[model samples]
Target: MSGFSRSCAAGLLAGATLLTTAACGSGAAETPPGQGDKPEVVAAFYPLQWLAEQVGGSDVQVTGLTAPGVEPHDLELGIQQVTGIRDAALTVYIKGIQPAVDDAVEAETSFDAATAVTTIPAGEHAGEEGEEHGHAETPYDTHLWLDPNRLATVATKLGERLAAADPAHAQGFKDRAAAAVSALGTLDQEFAKGLSTCKTKTLVTAHEAFGYLADRYQLKQVGITLDPDTEPSPTRISEVAKVAKAEGVTTIFTETLVSPKVAEVLASQVGARTAVLDPLESKPSGDYLSAMRDNLKTLQTALGCTA
Candidate 1:
C-alpha cells in the first residue's frame, strides 16, 4: 500500500480505538449516600474532563475519553470506553470535533435516546480566509476549555444537568459549579491581560486550534499551515509566509503531538520563531487550572506578553 493509503487506514483504526476507549473505565470512587452513590461522568476530551471535575466535584466521577498525547481532532473510541459512557449517569462531548466522538454520540443516542448528550456550539473562528475561515459546524469549537468564558458557560450547563440527574446534592453541585465558573473567569482574565498588551496580536499557529483563544483574547490569527486536520501543502507555506511577514507575527505556535516541519518552514520563510503550545487534549497530571497557567506562560512568551 502507498503512504497516503497507509496513513488513512491508520487514522481510521486509531479513530475506532479511541471510540472504544471512551466507553470503558474504572468509575468514580464510591461516594457516601445522598451524594449520588453511582455518579459517573464521561467527557470526550481533556478540557471537558477538567470542567467536569470542577462542576461535578466529589459528587460525581469523571473520565476523559482521549488519552494524553492524542490529538482531540482525530480521536478514536473503544467498546470498553463506550460501555463506561453507557453506565454513567451523564456523558458530555463536543459533537463535531472528532470523528470518534461524533460516532460515539451517535451510538449512545441509538442505545438510549434519552441519554443526556449536550452539544456545545464550538465558538466561531476569526482567522484565515474562505472555507477555512469562520465557524466550524460543530455547535462550537470543542476547545471550549481554551476560552474561559465559554468554559464557564459549559460548566454551569453541565452542573445543572448533573444536579438534575442526582438531585440529592443539587445545591452542592451548584456551589461547586459557581466556583468553577469564577475560576474560569480568573483564568480568562490572565489570558486577556497578557495577550491584550501583545506587541503584536497576530499569531501563526500550525493548526486552527487557537481559534477560540484568539477570539477571546482579540488576538489576530494571521495564518495556519494545515488544511483542517490534514497536513500543510508545500505551496500553502508560501501564502502563510507572506501573511506572517505582512502581519509582523514573530512566533509560530505548534502543539506537542503534531509535526513542526511546516511550522519550521513557515518560520524560516518569514524569519519568525516557533514555540510549542499545548492543546490540553489530555488532563495534565495537574488540574485544569495548572495546565491553563502553564499555557498562559507559554502564550505570554510567544506573544511577548509582559507584567
Candidate 2:
C-alpha cells in the first residue's frame, strides 16, 4: 500500500484497538460500523464523522447521526440516534451547521460528560440572536470544516484527545493527523490554483454559504441570495445582479441542499450560467479528500480556471 494508505490502515487499527480497550473495561459491547453499539462514537454530521475517522482510524468505531443524502439543517435525530450518542465514547457535531443536532446536544443531560462535541459555525451567521447563550453555548461560526486552515485546529484537538484516550497509539493518532493535514494542504493548493486563474476574481452564489471557501481562495463573493437561514428577496436578486455585472462574475453557483431558483434568476439577468456545488454538510459519496477534490474540479469549471 502507499505510505498514506498504510498510515491510514495503521491508525485505524490502532484506534479500533483503543476503542476495544475502553469498551471492554466499561462493559460496553463493541459494535460494527452498521450496528448501533454503545461506548462507540456518534458524529452529528458527515464531515465530523469523516474527520473523527481520520483521527480515530480502525481504533475508533463511529456512526453518523445524519445519513447520506440528508441535509444537516432539516435533520432530526430520533430515539435510536440518541441511543447511539449515549453509547459512544465521543460525539462530534458542528454547532450551527445543523440546528437539530445542536438542540439535541444542548438538551442532552445523559451523555453530557461522555460525548466529545465540536461545532462548526456558519461564518458570521452564528452571532445572530437564536444560537449562542453560554460558555457551553457560545457565539462562533460553526462551518469551521469548510476552511482547511481552521480544520487543522479541529484535527489537532481530536488527535490529542484520541492519543490521550489510547496512549498505546498516541503516536499513531498524531501521525494520522499529520497525514490529514498534508492532504488538506494539497486540496487548498488546488483551490488556490484554480480560483487564482479565474478570469474574474468574484463569485456570485445563491447563498452566503461559500464565504469560507471564497475567503480561502482569495475570491470575492456577491451573494444572489440571503443567509442560509432565509431565502432571497427580489431586491436582493437585483442587488446581486448589479454586483455580478460590476464584478464580471462568470457563473452563479448553488449548493446541493438549497433551491436553485435564485441562481437561475440571477444568472439570466447577468447572462451567466449556474453550477451545483456541494457544501458538504452531510456524508459525501467519498472521504473528505475526495469530496474536496471533486469540489475543486467543479469550481475550476464554474469559474473558468485555466489550470
Candidate 3:
C-alpha cells in the first residue's frame, strides 16, 4: 500500500465534502492515466471505493465519490463528478444508496455491486414527526456491505469485471480478489463466533443500516431513524425504547456521519449507554477490517456477547 503514495492510494484516503481531486477516491487525485495504464474506476462511496482498491489492486485507479464524514444517502454530485462517472472504466455503486449517482452512471460501463448478491427486502422506516422516509429504500436494502460474506461476493464479481475490462491484468485482479475474499471470510467467521452467544440478539441502532448485519448474524435491528436527515418521532422513539428495554439492550448505537441526538435521547430514556457503530458509510479511522473488528468488540460489550 505504501508504493501507492503517488499512485492511487492517496486519492482513496483524502476525503472531503465535495468532489474535488483531493476529496475523491484514491486515483482521482493524480492526473488520470492515459490508455494502457491502470484503469480508472469511480466508486460511489467509501465501502465500494475500499473494495475497488482492494480488488483492483495495482491494476486500477479507484476514486471515491462521497467524501469522508458525509452521509452517503444525502450525497449530491458536482458536474465534474458526473463527468467522471461517464468517463471512468467503471463506476461501482449500489443503485439505491444515492439516487444522483445512480442517475449519473452509464450502465454499460458501471458495475452495481448490489446485483452480485441475493438481497433482503428494503427496510421500512418513519421519521420523528410520524412521517415515512428511508435512507434510500429501493425494493431491497442496499447496506449489504455490513455483511462480510455479501461483500466477499461483490469482490469476486468486481475482479471479474475489472479483468474483463483490462484483460492484460486479469491474473492480478483474480489474485487480489481472492485475497479480499480470504480476508472477508476471516472477518465473517470472527463475527459469527463472537456474536454466537450474546445475551441479547436485539440490536437497537441509529438507523436501519444494520438490517443486513443483523440478518446475517441472526439478530434483530430496531432502528431509531429511518432517514438520515429526519429525527425519530416521540412515538417512534417510545416504541423503540420499549424494544430496547424489553430486550435489555445495553447500548444505543450511533454512526459518525449521523447526528447522535436521537440515540442519546433514546439511551437516556432507556437508561442505556451510547456507542458508535461504523456502518462503513465513510472512511473509518482504520480500514474496513480494523473498523469491523472494533465493531465486534462494541457489539460484544453492548450486547454482552461471549468471547
Candidate 4:
C-alpha cells in the first residue's frame, strides 16, 4: 500500500519497450479491478504466487510472474512486469531462483521468502556449466518450497506482511494465512508418515532441487546436475550411477521443466526406472497441495515404502 504510484512507476521506466509480458504468463490470471484500489502483490514464480493468493485471499490482487510449464530460473522480465514490481505493495520472490526478478525488485516493496526460514548450505554441483553456474547467488539453496513445514512458516510470515500492507483487510489476511498453515501442517504429517518405512532412502534426481525435501523426510538425494538447465557431465553422471547402484536406488527422479534424457540414461545405468518427482519450480497440473500429494505417492512407490 505504501509503494510507488502508477504515474511514478511508469515515469521510472523511461526507455521501456511497447511490448509487455504479463507476470501471469500461466497458472494465474489477472483479476478485473481487483488491484485498482487494493494492495497489489507480485510473485516472482508459481510457489510464491500461490502463497500470495492463499494468504492474501481476496484482499489483495495477486500477479504471478512465471508462466505455467516455464522454468523459473534465469527468467527474463519485460517492461510491464518490472513496472508492476515497482508499483506493487509487496513483491514476493525467492532471490536465487530468477536472477532477472532478483535485480528488478526494490527493497521497499520486496519480500524475499528465503529470508523467512533457516537455509541449508549449497551442495557441490558439477554440471556442463561447472560448479559456479549453480546457486552461487546465495550460500543456501533457494528451493525451500520442498519442505511443507518451512513453507507453512512462510505462510504465517506472509500473512503478517499482508496485514501490515492492508490494515483494512488485516484480519482476513491473517485468517487465510492460518488456514494455509494448518493445511501445510497436514501435508507435512502425510509426508512424514508415508515416507517413514521406505526400504531405500537414497533419491536420485536429475537436478539437485530436493535437498530440503530429503532433509525433511530423512532421505538422501543424489542429484545428477547442480543447476537448472545445465547438462550433467559424464563423470558426474557416472558418480551418481555408482551411488545409485550402491544405495539400491530403484528410480531416477525427473521433473517437469528439465529434460528427462539425462535421468533416463542414469536410470538405465543404475538398472532402475525413472519417475517424475516435481521440485515445484513452475506451475503444476494441480495446485501446490495436490502436486505435492502426487509427489508423495510417487516417492512412496519409488522408495518402496511399506507404510
What Cα-based lDDT does every candidate model obtain?
0.61, 0.61, 0.78, 0.78
Which model scores highest in TM-score? 4
Candidate 4's TM-score: 0.89
CA lDDT of 157 in candidate 1? 74
Pick by lDDT: 1 or 4, better one: 4
Model 4 CA lDDT for position 196: 97
List the RMSD of every prediction in angstroms. 10.0, 8.7, 5.8, 3.7
TM-score, each model? Answer: 0.76, 0.75, 0.86, 0.89
The count of backbone overlaps in candidate 4 is 1
The alpha-carbon lDDT assigned to residue 280 of candidate 1 equals 75
Per-residue lDDT of model 1, residues 160-270, tens digit only:
766665678889889998999898899888887877777778778887666677778888764464235456556567777887888777888887677888788888888
lDDT of 3 at 217: 98
Off by over 4 Å in 3: 1-36, 124-137
Per-residue lDDT tens digits for candidate 2, residues 3-44, read: 122233443443354344433222122334432221345666
User: Model 1, which residues run further than 4 Å from truth?
Assistant: 1-36, 106-140, 226-229
